[model samples]
Target: MTFDHNPRILFLYGSLRDRSYSRLLAEEAARIIAAFGAEVRFFDPHELPIYGSVPDTHPKVQELRELSIWSEGQVWSSPELHGQISAVMKNQIDWIPLSLGAVRPTQGRTLAVMQVSGGSQSFNAVNTLRILGRWMRMFTIPNQSSVAKAYEQFHDDGTMKDSSYHDRVIDVMEELYKFTILLRGQADELCDRYSERKQKGVQESMSDIGRMVNNVNLSQM
Candidate 1:
């Protein structure tokens, strides 16, 4: 299937530091995907409040949610903190509810996870991101990147150096782009769940009953 427009992909990085490796890595991936003809955007987590600390109507929260809805796919890059995905990453995901009224912002969207570490290479952050992706009902791509000693992998200019880790990031982005192109058209059908359909039917029936009761009350009056 061909897309009439470039596949839109949203990037979320975990960190607020001046030289956050996760952000750099995400930027690198964004560049790669952009070169492959995918439209990309990033949500700056600098002012995003902790989940539930503020109303969903908060500007930053609204921005993030809007980006999630606009995206055909997403990339989550986090720094491994204490051998797990950083809270910064989790907070961003938390802001985007699984269901927003009748629209499910993330369902069936393709996801790619990546992580950076100060020490040895570790998959902890990426692993946790994959779990979160599944929980959000997204299609997590098979390829992922975990940069060991991330500080060394990138140049002073925020561009990644030529290395195996860089190669893997390129691979992951390519796969994500391909998956999004292949699935964006069919995502809704692919993610259709019997349980949700049944629930929706029940809700509609209840609404009908309520309307009927209101009509009868009006007639009696």
Candidate 2:
């Protein structure tokens, strides 16, 4: 029997800081997710050209889009740059839209959000990301982790130091795994019913599938 081992997880980190706390938090989360049996990958948004900076043909933009399509779920991590998620993080989110040519890039995807605060702990970034996730039509998991004064939570060797915080990361990841499987199964059908266009050029194949098209009219439709 072929054992299915793949649960693709895309990790997005905010800030280009050499020692970004947000990146550290993401790394910690990635480690836990991998330990739990999912294959985790991180997005290097720095290489990604902004939404309008380069056209769709840009290598970085294409890279990001391809990654989004391939992943089962995503982990969005950002630093509280101000009282909210960093502009860099917001910019990356902005680049990921529901529509990408004929494909809806983020629609129906599952997401887990996290935040690292430079000062007193806060949920500003995660809350903002969750709102964005909803707008993108992705299913955002309810569990989340926020690391305050994140600088002191990791060691110079890049290992996470906080045990409680580590447990929260595990919780967030497990939730993402469950939601990803549950949502992907219904994604295509969900996209069809919820899409504003309705019918969306896909004529109901069966006479019984549509809004009382009736036997003869359904065939013509």
In candidate 1, what are the lDDT values of residues 116-196, reduced to their tens digit?
Answer: 999999998888999999999999999999999998999999999999999999999999999998896798899876567
Candidate 2 residue pairs in clash (backbone atoms < 3 Å): none
Q: Candidate 2 versus the native: TM-score?
A: 0.85
- State every prediction's TM-score relative to the real structure: 0.90, 0.85
Model 2 stretches astray by more than 4 angstroms = 1-5, 194-221
lDDT of 1 at 144: 98
Question: Distance from true position, residue 175, model 2, in Å?
Answer: 1.2
The CA lDDT at 194 in model 2 is 27
Q: Considering every candidate listed, which one attains the maximal lDDT?
A: 1
